[model samples]
Target: MNTDLMINRGIIKYNGNAFEEIDDVIANEYPLTIIVDGDEFATMVCTPDHLDELVIGFLASEGIIRAIEDIAALSINEDRGFAYVELVQKQTMSKDFFSKRFIGSCCGKSRQFYLHNDVKTAKTFMKQIEISVSQCFNLMTKMQEQSTAFQLTGGLHNASLCTKDQVLLSRSDIGRHNALDKIYGYCLKNKLSITDMMIAFSGRISSEVLLKVSKIGVGIVLSKSAPTTLAVNLANDLGITAIGFVRGQSLNVYSHPERIVS
Candidate 1:
């Protein structure tokens, strides 16, 4: 098994001419293939730590499984980084399953693999989680402090999910989406309730991200960057809260302002 490694790079100057050598930490990347009922679903380049959770979360985000219990068994080939999942009962895989192989996005959610129906049911829940701007900054600070990889390599993106009490889980990878998938998988495997949580990403809020959060029933999403217009529109239509450009003590609420407390 490969362990986390630290690498030393050249020097960089901060505040003055004084320079210091930088050291970074990162995990190894491996190809993880997901096979459902003996058929290939999707393959991702991810850290090999959470193959089972990644598979379960990927399936759930894709709308392949309605509930976490719908999955019966998940086997991971640690050596090969392959996962084979067996559902409790077989349901027809999406017709566009093959399409996922080609359509890749920078972050975790893929528009090419979206369901035809709109997320109308998500609009009914009027409950919103109010968080202060400083709290958003604090959460980001916590996320940054938890990112051992970025502190070292500075090449990977990180994603985390947090509740009012604390941050539940975080994952880092070269692909932002893969990081988010890791968190999703973690929650599914641990049987955590996602309805009362908010997701945080180191990337922009695109329609795909909104779609994934809505699918998981997360009421709010916060990002350290901007959001696409489609994402804002979808969040409003689905009654989800979208916060973006979250850095320091500021954030923009692009949709569902009712979720934010003044």
Candidate 2:
């Protein structure tokens, strides 16, 4: 068992009329408090692994920093589950900087952020990128195989940045949003071109998820699960290609089906 990412807990197993006491491995969830330039920012419930990337990604998704260079200094205290980050300029903080909200492992933004923005600020992705239907299935297969954490505990959500051929980066967390943020943060730090990439993840395609992908300027998103009605509408409005229910060789192209080659 990977202790850094999961923990062992005593449990009772029941199979039909048989029962047994045993220890089971479960994904660890910890509250990671992020402090930006000595001010208390927000706390996120996430898997303990990749604290740095989580912080950077969370900030980026919140519109706190635009590039990796914008981060002047960063340090994580695992003992306390806190991340201290300093930005190159204080002006980079969001207009709602002081409004602290407890972000759960499953969701990223607060309800207030969504209510205020109304998806109006989401970038309309105009990139002309086309992928074949076979490529979409292949990418989904790769994402499923690379998600070791989910396979181990069945409690983690996985996300990856991929090209038409392969997955470039992947991350897992208890929250779907955190997983996406980790990938975005990794790309930002490595100076990867997000506009040319697609995001594949193991979760439902919600409007919030679409918003995150749009914020990163990605035009395509693939998911193994279903998509909400609002998410499909948002994808059409944003000019994004959203594919859902990617199982084996089958998938539902909710919006922008023209991008998927036959």
Across 54-118, the per-residue lDDT of candidate 2 in tens digits comes to 88877777767778999999999999988999989985436474344433343532322343333
| TM-score for all models, in order of appearance | 0.78, 0.88
Indicate which candidate wins on lDDT. 2
The TM-score measured for candidate 1 stands at 0.78
In lDDT terms, how accurate is model 1? 0.70
* Residue ranges of candidate 2 with Cα displaced over 4 Å: 91-121
lDDT of each: 0.70, 0.82
Candidate 2, backbone clash total: 1
Instruction: Give the Å shift of residue 157 in candidate 1.
Output: 2.0
